[model samples]
Every structure is written in C-alpha cells, then in structure tokens.
Target: MSAPAKASADPAAPGERQGTRRRRHKGIAGNALWFWIFVGPFVVGLLIFSYLPIIWSLVLSFFEAYNTATPSKFVGLRNYVDMLTDHNFLSSLGTFTIFAVFIVPLTFVLALALALLVNQVKIARAFFRSVFFLPTACSYVVASLIWKLSIFNGVRFGLANTVLGWFGIENIAWLSTVDPPWYWIPLVTVRLWLQLGFYMILFIAGLQRISPTLYEAAYVDGAKPGWQVFRYITLPQLRATSVAVLILNLIAAYQAFDEFYNLVGNVNYARPPLVYLYSISLGSIQDLGHGSAGALILAVIIMIVTLLQNRIFGFGKAGD
Candidate 1:
C-alpha cells in the first residue's frame, strides 16, 4: 500500500527557517546602526579636537613655524639640535627633577595619613571629607594666588610671617631664596595641602574595598597598632592603588605650572619646564623654534616617566 500514499511533505518548513534567519540578520544590522549612531560624535570629536592638534603640534615641531603670519620653513631637526644645548632647558629639567624628589614622597605620606585618620574615625565622616576636599574643588589658579599672597607672602601682612614673628623666627623669604631651603618649602607645603585631599579620597575608596575580615585576621595574628598590618596585608592588597597614586603624583610634580607661575611669575629660580616652555613660546623673539622643540622634549620626558611607572608598577596588566 506504499505507506498509504506518502503524506505530502510540508513545503513551508524551509521557508519558515529562512524567514527567521532574515529576521536575525535584520536585528543585528539594527543594533550595529544604533551603536555607530551613538558613538560617532565622540569618535569625531576626539579625532578633530584632541588627536589632530597633537599631530599638528608634532609636525610643527619638525618645521620652523613662526608665531606670526610668517610661513613655516622646514629646518630639518635644527630645533631639536639647539634644544639639546640650551642652558635654560637644562636648568628647567634639573629644577623639575629636584621638585619631583621632594613632592612625590611628601604628598604620598600626607595623603596616607589623612586617609587613615578619616577611615579610623567613626563620627562626622561627611563633614571631615567635605572639609578636606574643599580646597581641591577650587581652581588651582585661585588656590595658588591665595597661597602666594595670603599665606607665603614675605611682607608683614602675610599670615605665615605674622605667626613667625610671634615665635621670634624672623621674616622668611618664602619665594625668593635660592635652593636647599627656600626652593621647595613653600611649594611643597602648598602642594601637599592641595593634593592630600584628592589622594585621601582615592585611598579611602581603596581601604573601604578591603574586607573587614582581613583586619580581623590581622588582629588575631597579634598585629600591633603602630607595628601594624600595613606592611603585611594592607600593602600587598593595596599595591595596585599605591602604584596609581605614585604615578599620578609623579605626573603632577612634573607638570607643575600654576603654583610656580602664580607664586614665582616666570622668574628663573621657581620655574619648572612647563613655565619655561610657556615663557619661550609667548615671550621670546629668537627661540620660537627652540621653544617648540623644548616642549616636544618635555612631552617626551613625561611620556617616558609615565611609561616607566607603568612598567615598574605593572599598572596596565590584567591582574593589576
């Protein structure tokens, strides 16, 4: 009977599968269109405003671009060659190094101390955090002016000088004195105050992430208050955060300009590399090529230092 005349096979089955496949393709295409539509503006903005300018600056560094309407002449590395021998460039580099040495360690310690205190406190937490972070909210320029004129001013009207008189320590030249003492004290002090709050916040975030169980474990292990869990448990766990703080502090120290400018006003003694670059770029007649070259060099130095930090600290590694 041939299986009672084989039932007619369903013809719509293959068509239904094909229709479902088309729907999936359409859905994927729609999602892709939406993604590009959303991200396109940001991508274009970065290309036009951020990266394009950097590219042009690098190109300008290669050619002799006049500050005026004068045409850019291709000088083929003359700028780079001259910057290598410039006395001012050398001086600025040395000064920045000295500043970094003092600023980085000091800021880290101050921030750590502030974080520990805030973490240990049980009351008025919001008030303490706000009080500490208030300075960071102010613009660097405003803060620098206050420190320069109001706090570190050498005159009798200055707050510090008034307090010094009460202690019989005499008037201290907070800005003008050369190295060993005057060079760093005021700058470091102000920088420490301004930076400690931000880093304290970072450390607070990191500390809060640590399990209370670890502290309890340390206590059970008889870890002393001063002799502390930091060296053992805390340090190991917070290694990544410590690296971040160090890298940030290092970059801040190197790029230090606002405080130097507001307080020292492009004077040689208090100038960092950035301040020197600004002066040459805007103020000098003969050194525009050299100035551009100096800036590129400074940029290179900063990049190298940042890369070194990443390498040593394993900052960008997956686990880190």
Candidate 2:
C-alpha cells in the first residue's frame, strides 16, 4: 500500500517542479535583458549605418539619381544595359585587367623576396624595415606629384631627362608617349614602389609563423643553402596567408584611383575604372547616373572576381 501511494505521488511532483522552472525562466529573461542592454548600441549602429546605406545604394542603382538639379527618374536596368554597350566601360575593364595581370604577380613575388631578405639580416633590420615601409606612410597624391613633376617629368628640367642628357641622348617625352614607352613603365614603377612594403610586412608575418624546427629538419636532410625549403614546407604552411595577400592585392589593383588620378589626371591612357567614373561624374560632366552605373558595374565585377578566387583558391578556408 505505501509503495503504491509513493508511485502515485510522483505524478503530482511535476507541478512543484514546474514552479521551479518558471523561476529559472524569469532569471534567464533578466539576464538576456542585461546582455541586450550592453550590446544594443553596436547592433543599432550596424543596422542603421551599414545595412541602411547598402539598402539605399541598391535602391538608387535601379533609379537615375543625380547630384545636379535634375529630379530622380526610375530607369530600372537601363543604366546596366547601357554599361554593356559603353566603349569607355569596356576600355576601363581591359585597362584594369592588363594592370592586374602584371601588378598582382609582381607585387606578390617581390614582397615575398623582400620579406625573406629582411628576415635573414641580423643587423639594422629595424632600420631597413622602416626604410622600406616609409613609402606607404606617404600619401599617394604626394608621391604621384613628386614622380610626375620631378622624376618622370617629360621636360628637360626633370631628373630623368637630365640623366639621359649625360648619355648624349635627347630628353624624351616620357608621359605623353602612347603605350609601351610612356604610360606603363612609370605607372608600374610607382605602383610597385608604393605597394611593395605593405605586402612585404604581410609576408614577413607569414614567414615568422613558420617553425624554425621545420627548416632545421629540412637542413638535416641535406637541403642546400641556395635550395629553398619553401616548396615542401614553407609554402604549404603559409598557403592561407598567400591566398589572403593575393585577394587583397586583387582588390587594391581593381579599385586603384588616387595614384592614377594624381599622376595622369583625366588622361584615358592610364585611367582605371574608378578614375574614369570620377572623370565622368565629378570632373568633366555632371553625369551622376552614368557614374553610379559605372560604379555599380565595377562592384559586380569585383564581387564576381572575389567569388571566383574563393572557389579556385579556397581562400576562405582556415589552417584546417
């Protein structure tokens, strides 16, 4: 009889247990309130600033938004379709593609080499690193202005022309010359000089992460002085960092504007898409719709390139 009564009482015990659970539920709700209070500012800011702006941009891309006195007009995909047929848009893409083809690989290789050399040095390492990175601290406009007026200036007053005179050669027009001679040489030179140090720092950090013991093991296996352990050990270990540096270089090369703007101004010979967009909207004519259309097209291209790179190189993968 006592065992049967105890068994029957067990079913009623849940009611008391339910009261305990209700207390715990109230406590959890209070804790959640406090957590939200602490984090609410950041959440609100992101929603208002970042997300809202993105929504606005997407909306504006569908309509003709002007910076001038004209009223906004709904043009759907007219801007996008016009972009496909625009010769200047095609030229800009072609120009940037060519620039990236040369610049990206060159930047990566040179930066890696610089990092290796700097890492191996025992003395004045800090000084050399600072010297290399100094160019990055300078504004692109300042560097471009100096290069335009002093270094690669086409005038007899320029340092380059002065040097050529020493070899009994006539002072040549450096900037005005069409392609292989004028535009690319100085552009590539300045671009490399400015960007190399930043990428070198990234590579140096990657190199430091590699274990010295691995290098020692390779050396024990009779790895020669000039022959690198990079093929087997260093590269595999630093694959993530290499992919990161490549992606960053790709984005920078595509969005390049300040250097080209200051050096070449409105000159189409070396104009990148961003520069051309600026020329159309802000500089020459107040064609805001065209500029926005160009900008949106560029955004799409960047997105596509990023996706392709991620797929090909597994860029988003961590060390695992």
Backbone Cα, N, C clashes tallied per candidate: 0, 0
lDDT of 1 by residue, 143-184 (tens): 878888888888887899999899888788788777546747
For candidate 2, the per-residue lDDT at 24 reads: 93
lDDT value, residue 152 of candidate 1: 88
lDDT of 2: 0.82
The pairs that clash in candidate 2 are none
Structural RMSD, model 1: 6.6
- Specify the poorest-scoring 10-residue window by lDDT in model 2: 62-71
Question: Model 1 segments beyond 4 Å from truth?
Answer: 1-41, 179-183, 284-287, 317-320
Candidate 1 — which pairs collide?
none
Score candidate 1 by lDDT: 0.80
